[model samples]
Target: MMISRLSAIATAPMRNGLSSASMTSAYAELHCHSNYSFLEGASHPDELVARARDLEMPALAITDRNGFYGAVKFFGAAQRAGIQPIVGTELTIDDGTTPPKDRVDYDRWGERLLLLVEDKLGYTSLCRLISMAQMPNAKGVARLPADQLAPLSGHLTALVADPKERLPFYQEIFGRDRVFIELHDHLAPDDRSRNQRLLELAGRYAAPLVITNEVFYATPDRHKLHDVLTAIRHRTTLDEAQRYLHPNAEHYLKSGAELRRVFDRYPRDIV
Candidate 1:
C-alpha cells in the first residue's frame, strides 16, 4: 500500500494550470515567502529552494509580499537544483476609496491576493501591476485598486484566501478557470472551519481549490525564528505578538507524502 501510494503521488498530473514540461512532481508549492517579504519571512531564497529540492519537489514559488525582490536569487537556485522556478507575489489591493491613517498603514488597508505567472505575458503583467502599486505610493507603502487587475488579468492565475465577496470580481476579471480558492491549514483551531467555508464557496462558484502551507521558513525548527520575525514586524515582544504568530510549526517545506497526509481528506487539492 505504501509503495502504491507513493507511486501514485509520483505519477499524478499537476492540475493547477501550470505547465509541467520540466516539473514532474505531483505537488508544487505555489504560495511561499522568503526573507525578502521584509520581517514577515524568515528564510532566504536559497534556503527555501534547497529545502524544496531536498523534499523532491519539482517546482517551488516565491510569492513574497508586494514585490519580487528575491525572484532573481530564487531563479538562480532553482536552476542549479534543476527544478522549475515559479515567480509570483502576494499583492495587497486597496481600492483607494478609504484614506489610511498613515503611509505605514498600507498593510491594514488592503486585501491580499496571490498571483502566479503563467508565461512571459504573465511576467510582463506582474511587473506592470507591481509598478502601478508602488510608483505613486510612499517608499514602503504599496497597494493597488481592483481596477488595475482587468488590464493585467490575462496571463495570471489568482488564488483567493479570504473576503469571499471579492471572489466573483476575480472570476470576472481573470476568468473562472484562472481564479482558484486557496486553502491553508496551519493546524490551528480555526483552520477546519475556515477551510470548510472556503470549500463551500468553491462549490458555490464552481471554482477549483488549491492547498498551500503558506510556508514562511524552510523547516519546523525555524518556527522560533519565524515567531521572532513576526514580533519584530509588529514592533512588539513575543508575548504581546502571540495573537499574530502562527499557532503551530506546520508551515514548513513539506514533501508530497507529508502534504498528502496533511490534507488527506482533500487530497485532490494538493496541486
Candidate 2:
C-alpha cells in the first residue's frame, strides 16, 4: 500500500468509544521499532498494536530504523484494534565526521534522529530521506548528510535521539516548533544523567520535550531473543556482541502509569 494511504488508515478516528477524552490524554509511544527493522525489533507490528490497545494508549508510531517497511502492516493492525498509528522512521544522520576504520567503530558512528510524518508531504519527505540514505551506501550502513536534510524538513517533526550532541543542527534546520528533544530512560545506570542533560538542552534551546521508550520488543521477556537478533545483525555471537547488547531488559513498552512513575518530574513531556 502507498504510505500515504496507510497513514490515512492509521490516523483515522477511533471507533467504539476508544477516542474518549480521557484516553486521548494518555501517553503515545512515538518511537517504536517492529520486526521490519531487520532483527533490531523483536515483535510483529500486530503484537505491538495489541499490547498498546490493552494499555489503552491513544497513539503509537512504528518507527523502524531507517525505513517504513512495517508501516502498512502497523496501520492495518491499528485500524483493526482501534488505536491511532503515527508513521515515522528513525534515521541515522551523517555529520561528515571521520569514516569508521572497522565494523565495530562503524556501529558507533552517526547520530540517530526520529522523523515523524504529520501529513502526506511529511510522508513523501521521509521516503526521499530514506532513499538518500540507502541508495548509495554500503550494506548495513545507511545515512544522509546533515545539509541534505535541511531543504526536506517541511511537514515533518524531528526528535533528536540524543539532544546533547545533535540538537544544534536540528534546531537550526527544523526550528524549535518542528523539533522536539526526546527524553528516554531505559533504567540504564547512566539514564538519569542522560535525561538530565537532555532537559538542560531543552531549556537552553526552548524546545519542547517528548518522552519515548525506544521500544525494541513488546515485553521484557523477549530481550534475550532481541539480543540474539542484534548479534546476528552484527555477524557475531552473544558473547562477542556484549558491546552492542542492551544492558538490561527494560526496553519494552511501558504503560502510561509506569511512564509517569519513571518520569514523574517531567509531566509535561510524558503527554
Best by TM-score: 1
Alpha-carbon RMSD to native, per candidate: 6.1, 5.7
Model 1: lDDT of residue 93: 88
Q: Candidate 2, 70: how far from true, in Å? A: 0.7
Q: Rate the local accuracy (lDDT) of all candidates.
A: 0.76, 0.76
Cα distance off (Å), candidate 2, residue 59:
0.8
After superposing candidate 1, which stretches have Cα over 4 Å from the reference? 1-25, 95-108, 265-271
Expressed as tens digits, the lDDT of each residue in 41-145 for candidate 1 is: 789999999998887786778999889999999999998997778889999888545646544433456788988887788888998999998898778877888
Cα-based lDDT at residue 172, candidate 2: 83
TM, every model: 0.86, 0.85
What candidate 2 gets wrong by more than 4 Å, as runs, is 1-25, 98-106, 265-271
**Model 2 — TM-score against the truth?**
0.85
Clashing pairs in 2: none
